[model samples]
Target: MEPQLSHHVEGAVATVVIRHPAKRNAMTAAMWRALPPLLEGFARDPGVRALVLTGEGGTFCAGADISTLQGSPAQAQTLAMAAEEALAAFPKPTLAAVRGHCVGGGAQLAAACDLRLAEEGALFGVTPARLGIVYPASSTRRLVSLVGPATAKYLLFTAELIDAARALGTGLVDEVLPEGELDKRVAELTRVLVSRSQLTQAAAKEFTDGRTDRDAHWAERADGNPDTVEGVAAFLERRQPRFTWSVAAPGSPSSSGSPSSSGSPSSSGSTSG
Candidate 1:
């Protein structure tokens, strides 16, 4: 099959799978270009509480397809950066479920997610040095934030792959699991995320990302919101809380699905690249 980004929503979780197994799920330029719009759509959808980005088969992304980088390297880098930025800016929580090689652009995308869960034997590397390409400043900063300058330099300077254990120790991945437990753990965590308050999640995302100016804005949103009241009542009654607030950005289409709604999901795929 042609390489593509395939997505499907099940309840509150939307999963985007990278499918280019012939090249170990390397992303093509078109795939990189498609990512921002896909993430924008999910950001607008009230029903999408969480997102999972992963690769087809057992491997995560292998980076940009080398053939596409042979010419117009700058253009390819631009598209990859755009995609990484989009993923980083997505309002909802996102997790990268990694199992195999995550290198170059692949590592870029994974690092953009809010969290990363890797299989025990997965490998990770930032490989711009291998191709003699200068990594973007923004990406370098993000890598530094996650793994610290020392660890980030080690990977960037040598383009050497690190095992999942070292990645977890460096904070490049949040969790590392045995081979068969990734999907189950991902599902469990996403279900917990879906059960939480969007008001809390959205505000925390902003503050943690260094947006100090949004305190009053989030406070205003929290004020008089039913989620707080419901949470208290649920605690008193020893019942599960039902968070009702959903993010509906301006100019985006509205959906009937609320934070607690279990609406039927739909799937789509794009084979452009």
Candidate 2:
């Protein structure tokens, strides 16, 4: 089957799955082209508080579908870079639930996400060196930020496949779980993320990504928001806070509701591309 990007929402969390079992979820050029718009849709949905990126058939992405590279390598790289940037810019907290091979372009995608969780026995590498292709600067910077210059150099220079344990030790993956437990743990973490304030997460994400100038607006934005009031009240009352202040989309009416209480996000849909 052709590789595709698929996503579904459960409650306030969205899962974007890479599906191409015939090639161990290797990404096709079409799949790369499809990601930015799909992620934009997710960003515009106020109810989507967090996102999880994974792959079907028990594998994450193996890398780019090399067969497509025979036609136009530059096009493939450009599309992949665009998708990586979109994932990095997504406002909500994003996690990559990695299993099996996450190498080459697959590794680039994982690096772009805020966090990575891998199952035991999973493998990771950046194989541009092996392919005699230069890695993109943005991806290299993100990798260096995550694992530091020394380790980043090692991975890029050697193009060696590292196991899940090594990935975690090198700070590439935030956590490593047994195969059967990966999904449950990812769901649990994402649920926690959904229950928190989107305003706080967005601000923190921006600041951590080196936009310290945005810190000035954080206090002003937090001052009148109901999320702070509810959070404080819930803390005093010794109960879970019901955060209702969903971030409004550009030019859209602001809506408020307890995401935890709601069965799911207001919008729930899936598409393959």
Candidate 3:
């Protein structure tokens, strides 16, 4: 099949598959451009409560197809950065389910997610150094935030692949599952994410990303919200809380009692060369 980003929603979760198996699912320029708009659509869809990013078959992404870097490298970099930012800014929970190799731009995409689940033998690296390319400042900062300055420097300087165990020890991934267990673990976590409150999740995402101006906005959202009430009532009754509050679409009034549409934030025709 031609390289593309394909997605399907199942019971409040959207799973996006990166298909470029011949290249270990490397993202091409077209694939990078395709991601932002695809994520925006999911963000606006009220039915989507969480998203899982995974590669088709055994491998995750190997990175951007470096052969495409020959001409107009600036434009290609711009597209990749845009895609990464879109994923990072997505209000709902997002997770990367990784297997095989996840290096370079692949690592950037995985780091952009709120959580990452990797298979035991998966290998990860940040490879701009190998190509004499300077990584973007934002990407570097994000990397440093995830795995710390020392480990980030080690990866960036050496361009060496780290095993999943080391990646986990250094905080590069949230979970490292046994072979054949990645999908099951990802499903379990995503279901838990779907059952939670979007109000809390959205606010926490912004705060964690270093946005300090939204405290009042979130305060208003929490005041008299049905989610808070239901949570309390459910706890008292010894039952699971049914959180109904969804993010409101941009410029739409946020309602406290029911699920509402959310404000926003792919596909390739297929890279790692």
**Predicted model with the maximum lDDT:** 1
lDDT per residue as tens, model 3, 1-273: 677888888888888889988788989998998887678767767788999999999889999987789998888889899999989988789999999999999999999999999999999999999998889999999999999999999999999999999999999999999999998999899899999999889889988988888789889888998899999999999999999887744442332212332443222222221
Which residue pairs in candidate 2 collide?
A: none
The C-alpha RMSD of each candidate to the native structure, in angstroms, is 4.2, 4.7, 4.2
Writing each residue's lDDT as its tens digit, candidate 2 over 71-150 gives 98888899999999988988789999999999998999999899999999999999999888989998999999999999
Comparing candidate 1 with candidate 3, which one achieves the higher lDDT?
1
Q: TM-score for each prediction? A: 0.93, 0.91, 0.92
Q: Whole-model Cα lDDT per candidate? A: 0.87, 0.84, 0.86
Q: Which residue window of length 10 is worst by lDDT in model 1? A: 252-261
Separately for all candidates shown, the number of backbone clashes (residues 3 or more apart, or on different chains) is: 0, 0, 3
User: What's model 3's overall lDDT?
Assistant: 0.86
What TM-score quantifies how close candidate 2 is to the native fold? 0.91
> Quick one: how many clashes does candidate 3 have?
3
Q: Point out where model 2 deviates above 4 Å.
A: 249-273
Best by TM-score: 1
| Residues 1-273 of candidate 1: C-alpha lDDT, one tens digit per residue | 788998988878999999998999999998998888787777767778889999999899999999999889999999999899888887788999999999999999999999999999999999999999999999999999999999999999999999999999999999999989999999999999999987788778778777788788778777888889999999999999998777754422222122332333345556457
